[model samples]
Target chain A: MSLNVVSLVSVGRHPQSGRARRADQDGRAVELGLKLVAKALSVVHVGDPDDPVLRQYAGMGLPSMTILKQDKSIDAVPILSQFLQQEKIDIVLTGVRAESGESSGMVPYLLAHALGWPVVARVADIVSVKDGEAQVLLALPRGQRRAVSVKLPFIASVDHAAEIARQSAFALGLRASIESVESVGEVDRIRVDWQESVAKSRPKRLKTVKAKTAAERFKAATAKPEGGTGKVMKNETPKEKARAIFDLLLEEKVIR
Target chain B: MSNVSSLGISSLGIVRRDPRKEWIARNRLHPLYHEVINEGLGSVVGPSGLIRKNPHQIGFIGPNGIKRIDRLKGNGADTSNKRHGSAQEVVLPLHVVTTPDFYLVVVPDLVGGRLSSHDKDILGLAHALQGGMEGNGAVVAVCFGDVKETQFDLAGVDRLIHLTGTEFEGFTPEARVAALVQIDTQLAPQHWLFPDSIHGGTDLGSRLAASLGERPATQAWQVIPEKVVCRGAGGSLDIARQTPRIVMVLEECGNAIDETRHEVLPISVDALEIQSAHLIDHGQVAVDPNEIPLAEAEFIVSAGNGIHNWAQYHQTAQALGATEGASRVAVDDGFMPRFRQVGASGTWVTARVYLAVGISGAIQHMQGIGQCEKIIAINTDAGCDMVKRSHLSVIDDSDVILSELMQLAQEYGVNDKPSQENSPEESQNVA
Candidate 1:
């Protein structure tokens, strides 16, 4: 027996300009994350049957996926919790962070507590499991690693490193089916202590450092750091020499 | 150790979400926080159904190596918050010592393969606790302080121990628990508290439970004097059993009190010196309360997958001057960052004009954006869920209707300006 668990997806609206002009950004991340989830769960359900995520897998005649529909007003956490209990789910897995609202980074924690399941955050890999417990990898700072053992019927937040999630090609993206669900309770906005949204904008940090020539864009891209060759100001006095060194350092960010 | 005799059983564990290793202790087996890794207490089976004798022991751990906070400049900040004006008070890092088996905390240095002085301090603490003793363990932390913008002070403690090292920067969940396990076994405290940051509760809670011999709970509420009560679910056990007497802080429910005091004394090893901390510059912008606050917003509109070609909806957004988004589509398309997506990821928005243009109303996509006073959906298919769920369904083709609206807008003269609507002052962000 398997739990008809549903993968709840959510998004945040851009605080300022409400226009999305690119393609495949969500498709790639979602599709990749979905493949990772599939490797861990026995029965996976989705909220939107028509989602591009479902279509991606349709060609491979991949495993069955279900969708639940309701008034958009429904509070997902409660809805998901009730569904998990109702379906007797063994566990739930979601991303360490979603791209949208309340970026408070509270969902996985809240849901695990709400569903009464253990949660593993930013898990890199699920090593193995047989009798309720499992050994998993929690990627550490840098490329370092650590091995953690925990019990099952728990929640885990997957990191991009968990595994290279698979892709659903053109063929598989077609045969997915859309399932219908009945209406449920809807969660309305709780106007207590509203969080004001900061207008969102991407920070401009990229610097164009090309060695003077537009035609050499490709060459410049492949170029390595050109080692500087300059004599040390060892013979000069401390104060005068220090001033020159500081100026050079500022040009290269070698010093503040 | 202030009060060890009053120790009660509290299960503290990060949500254990490893989908693989199948050990009996792994079966909801909570790892100890402080003592297990320090002296090699081995392991034990708990009433929660975890039985582990695993050899991956946490050896002695402590902070070592004194970094005298440039005594000259430090002497001034130590007296008062006046002379330094904008600078925060300097506090030192007071960590117990440890060895390689003890796991050091290294930040950028560790990644770059250079161990910092703190890393060596970790070895010192571990070596001292280990005292030529074999096996892995961790130093116990009865209490620690926030060393924000400060020097690590060794004032007011029994002994100055060091297990400082480069490996001890921010630790992975496994390493954190590995180090904590030793401390848990050695010193089980009655009153336990953790940093109220995002990284703490997620894994730290679960690790504490496994080490401390108690079922730890996350997001503690009111501490009823002697007893600490927490609010969280204890997953895995089908049977109900009360393994009582422990306290934990709840999540996002309360503001964490700044804990900036802990005593330290240099035993035979001189002072527990602290190096200068990374400088910080902070500022705040005030928001005028009398604005078109989100709560007071009468009309709210959200976009989703239904709006295929954005150009088609230009006139629609312009006509209504509504904030637009998707059920996870526009967000991924770079039309916006994922933060703006309308489902489980984005804000839970609700207002008067809830319009779903070309949105399929997927659950994840809908959860964040679906709420509004009135939802009007325009899609070609009457059968689509968007048509069924919206307050008003426009069955005409999206391209046709949007284009028609755009033409009408140009004819009507209010096309290019979104500023013509309601209040110009409302256009600003949360600030």
Candidate 2:
């Protein structure tokens, strides 16, 4: 049986320039969805229907996009969960976290809880789907991966380690039709209490010396700082220099 | 008599002291005083039959080749001796909470069966929160799987709930969350803190928060009893909100507890009836070094324009068991793929050890490798920026170093064959 896949996209802010653009992981989610069921993949957005950034996502070869028209202050969970329940989607894909707003990364879990469906986090790839179960790979730190098999009708959050989204074509994006659905959204009351401000850079933790004795305090104050100048091997033999590099590699445990 | 023994005279046998040598040792102006005295100017028997100590000669040479004096005298001798591995155990005062009015729960990621630095930071934040409130508050750490963390006391865990079973092993988030849910009902903690990390911490925390119906604060850096400051909008804006019951904290949220030890009292949770999980874990997949992405790779060997033999560079990376990386010039020249490029414009690598061969480091390239712990440069020019940034630099021809390194690696691989065989077999078993 053909699987019904839906990818959720969001407006992303560029980390450096703070410009509104296509979100990174959300685009990857769409790419993964396209890879799964290319022809049947449906892209959905929950914000403004007139957003120009929505076209960038559509430019990923989507013929059209469905936008659930809602205001920015609305709680997306209730609205999204309601919309998803009606679609009867076999698989719902989303970014691990949104790049804008709260960026709390709780939408998938909250949606899963509301729908009573299992949600997989940080999925690197969906290896296969067979016998109503999909084998997925989860990304771990240090280039590690965990393989898992989850039943269909589940939610998955795409990781950055997944295949990158294809480039957007301006002409294709302009031709794609945008279907807007009007929906009344409940205003989020809790967010009103939050005070938003420009982020202040955190201070780098300094190495504080906890000396019990006067001599140690003196040593800590007067001792020359470490690791400024590196050892340069100029006239050493090739064997000696190679041995030095090898020893350093071994010390770092990178050559194991 | 003790002074005479310290002066190199045998205590068992009575020996006659030469008057000339004794006079030379006693006389500070005497040129032969240092040579005649076996012990340096520490302490000596004065002419008045009292022990005289030269306060200036109380210390030994420090590691930086400078003379340092210890003011604590003989009391500080063990501090220096501790470096020789016969450490005098310095026991910190224990912090015990007999009656906890409230509980601050911490669920650590504990990567590799040990409390990671991120875990410790959250634990510290839990303690800071505990300190801010009234009455006795205990920081309870809920850990899963095989816990190899022996220093939980040092990490400021007042109470430990270690759950170890086949169900809690591997990627069993469902079973782990079930256990946490049971703890929540039993303890009814005032606050729940988790490390906002990619290593299952955020996943489990969000899952628990969703099930508990608590709107958790994510990426929280500054947290207190009254308020929490968290980063939002991809770290561009900070949102200060009233502290929530569930908080996912960022690294360095608080300083790690170093001064005092905790009880680490073992706690138990009542039996949890875990529902049938929809996800089944098949364990980890073996990824080849070359297949791993440059950003997540722990060790990277990158090439640049100075590399004459492209084949030799690839072979060197293979031998070193490192992910292949290339400079912008190498990618621009079509020697490497675009994804293999390492720079500000390309993939920023967090490799523990970055080996740059023949790359004169550009400003953007240096910025990319800022987080790398150790950088080794093999360049012809000694004055290059890469060489300057490197912790260990070899000013030589790249061709010579690459060939030498390859041979050494081959020999090392042969010697390390026995240990390396286990990894392949383990991967095969997983498959």
> What's the count of clashing pairs in each model shown?
163, 0
Model 2 clashing-pair count: 0
Model 2, A139-249: lDDT tens digits are 998887899999988999999989999998888898899999998789999998999999999889888999877867887899985666488999999889999999999
lDDT string, candidate 1, A218-250, tens digits = 657887754322233334433433344233323
In the range B268-386, model 1's lDDT, one tens digit per residue, is: 32223333221111111111112223333333345555566654554355453444445566666555444445657665665545556667677765565445544566555667666
Listed models, DockQ each: 0.01, 0.54
Docking class of 2: medium
* CA lDDT of every candidate: 0.41, 0.86
For model 2, how does the per-residue alpha-carbon lDDT over B1-431 read when each residue is reduced to its tens digit?
Answer: 11221223345533334556555545667786556443554687899999999876655544344665544322222334224222347788999999899999999999878998989988888898899999899999999988888999999999999888888888898888889889999999999999999888899999999999999999999999999999998899899999999999999878888989999999998887888888999989866676787898999999998899877887777778888888999888877877788999999999999999989999989888988999999999999999888999998999999999999999898233333222232223221
Model 2 alpha-carbon miss at residue B50, Å: 16
Across all models, the iRMS values in order are: 26.6, 3.6
Chain B of candidate 2 versus the native chain B: what TM-score?
0.69
